[model samples]
Target: MQDILIVDGYNVIGAWTELKKLQKNDFELARDFLINKLSEYQAVTGWRVILIFDAYLISGKETKTKKSKIEVIYTKKSEKADQKIEGLIKKLQNVKTRIHVATSDMAEQWAVFSQGALRKPSRELIEEIGQIEKEIKRSTANTHRSSSMTKIQLDDATREKLEQMRRGF
Candidate 1:
């Protein structure tokens, strides 16, 4: 069974301070930042991540794209992200799947919960991402240290030959 995380894009952008600051200057930058962060989270967790952004005010059909192995969805005109998320929960929920919806909206939390999907508040998701990043850094440092300490075993003759080659002998 696989875990799925569905994020409400704007909701999280509003909730996260860094994203909110970027949004004040450039909306696209904020969205891109969120997508990149989510991509990293998806890579670390091995969960299927789907991020939904509201396109309800614009006139167009729903659009879905893949970014860094994660899904990015833009709701169609007149269709809110909340609606699309709920629809996705209904379509994807099953006994073998664990669905988690990330949003700070109370109404949305309740809605997804009632559909048997778990609710992860935006604040919680932010903290989880922070922890994951720290783990990655620690793991990378350990790997580097271990690799640098590794010694390759060589016969005496081979070692002498390598040393001679290094001196251009």
Candidate 2:
């Protein structure tokens, strides 16, 4: 069973400095940025990521969509993201499946722990994502270096000449 990561979208946005700054100018853009980051995190960690945004104050039905292989959920009217996240933890928790909830809410963390799911603070999640991104950069650099090296194809005679030169022949 794959690991699951449930993110409380607004909470994370409030906790993350970059997102908070972006949110001040454009809320939608901040949300989109968060989703994009989570998508990358999901790809790197191979975890099923579900990001929940609260629409409790907005009169509308709940919406769920898939973006870059990650799930984005807007909670229904009168339903908070925390409630939805808890519900998901309850539904997905099992011996073989490891569920993680990311939020800065202490109450939410306790609730998640009670449901047998792991809790990741928003700051911690940010750090984890940063580490993953660094790893990706390093891996990409290594791949580029290797591909460049392989791109230079030498003929058998050229290879033999270089080998003899190296041997001082």
Candidate 3:
């Protein structure tokens, strides 16, 4: 079974210095940036990523949507992100699923840990993301280098035939 990663959206944004600054200027951009980065992480890790945002400022029902193949959820006005994450952990917990919640809130971390779900502090999660990004970069560089280093040697006859095909036929 695939592991699940539950991210506290606002909590992470507030905890990350760059994201916090970006949020001050344009809140939507910060949210979008977080979503995009998480989507990339999800693609690389092959884990089920669910990002939960609190709707404390807006009056509406909770909403769930998929953006870039990642699940994004906004809690109802009465519900907070932590509550939504906790509830999801409970529901998704099973022998086949390993649930991990990412949040900087101490109380929330303790609660999740007590519930048998692993907790990742905001900083640690951010570092893990950085590592993933670095690994992707390294692998891409290696691929380019290896492809350039290794050449497919074609004999004169084969090369002439391929060139003739390209010309016509």
lDDT by residue (tens digit), candidate 3, 20-81: 99999998999999999898889898999999999988999999999998899999999989
Comparing 1 and 2 on lDDT, the stronger one: 1
Q: 1 or 2, which is superior by TM-score? A: 1
lDDT of 2 by residue, 101-137 (tens): 9999999999999889999999999999889889999
Query: Best-fitting candidate, measured by lDDT?
Result: 1
The count of backbone overlaps in candidate 3 is 0
Query: Could you tell me the TM-score of candidate 2?
Result: 0.86
Model 1, position 122, has a per-residue lDDT of: 98
Cα error, residue 48 of model 1, in Å, equals 0.5
The sequence of per-residue lDDT tens digits that candidate 1 reaches over residues 1-169 is 9999999999999999999999999988998999988988999999999999999567889999998887999999899999999999999999999999999999999999999999999999999988988998999999999998898989999999999999999
Per-model TM-score, in order, reads 0.88, 0.86, 0.88
Q: Which ranges in model 2 have alpha carbons more than 4 Å from their true place?
A: 151-169
Question: Which rank order by TM-score, best down to worst?
Answer: 1, 3, 2
Candidate lDDT scores, in order, read 0.94, 0.92, 0.93
